[model samples]
Target: MNVYLGLGTNLGDKEQNLCRAVQKIEERIGKIVSLSAFYATAPWGFQSDNSFLNAAVCVETSLPPYEVLKETQQIERRMGRNYKSVGGQYKDRVIDIDLLLFGDIVMNEADLVLPHPLMTERRFVMEPLAEIAPDLVHPVLGQTMKELNA
Candidate 1:
């Protein structure tokens, strides 16, 4: 299955954390198919002291979307994400891995949302996504990355 993962780090060797996350993914589920160049970005929400390093990884995986999201969260916690509440939103994570898209799937259940609800709106997400999948359509919007980016 074609899958995309969004990786971010704002603490403790951001680039190294990204590399290690890639290694772990390769060892666990699938080989990395493509990786967008890392981008240095301002924090998108919930301001913090550190700026974030962000990138996107496209991989083929047999794991289902929910399974992938679950595993990715575990990986994040293991990588030293800590939680503080900011109006009930988790904050201050060292590393974060979000399941941006799982093939063309879309589901809005209690635990997960596919095609990533805000992906199109975030320049950080869209810029990297367009690099790797300019022709990719937003499952919900039916718009290509180039269209969305525009």
Candidate 2:
């Protein structure tokens, strides 16, 4: 399966954090097919003095969506992230790995959501995603990444 992931960090060595996360993803998940340039962005939902350095990645993996989520979460935990933003409460962290898309699958389980619910609305995600997968379409929105980014 081809999956898209959004990586961001507003704490510690931002560049190294992203690099390590990408490396771990390749080692534990799958080969990285595409990676966007790192982008500097502000905190999205919560106020923070730290600004985030964000990027997007496309990986080809044999693992199912749920497994992908589990691995990504584990990656975050191993990298010093204490908790995920819950109930729309965001925070600065050492690393955040969001599973943006899992092929064309649309799912709404309590733990995972494919074609990430807020991906299109966030420039931090769409800009990098559009960079690497301009023509990739959102299964739920029926719009290409390029279009969404615009």
Top TM-score hit: 2
Candidate 1, residue 61: lDDT: 90
Clashes of each: 0, 0
Q: Give the alpha carbon lDDT tens digit for every residue of 1-110 in model 1.
A: 98988888888898999898888777666878989999888877677878888888898899988778777877777777645334446455678887888889989986
Off by over 4 Å in 1: 82-90
lDDT of 2 by residue, 34-146 (tens): 99999999899899999999999999999999889989999999999979888998888999999999999999988887879999889999999999999998999899999
Off by over 4 Å in 2: none
- For all candidates in order, the CA lDDT equals 0.81, 0.94
Candidate 2 lDDT (Cα, 0 to 1): 0.94
TM-score of every model versus the real structure: 0.91, 0.98
> Could you tell me the lDDT of residue 42 within candidate 1?
83
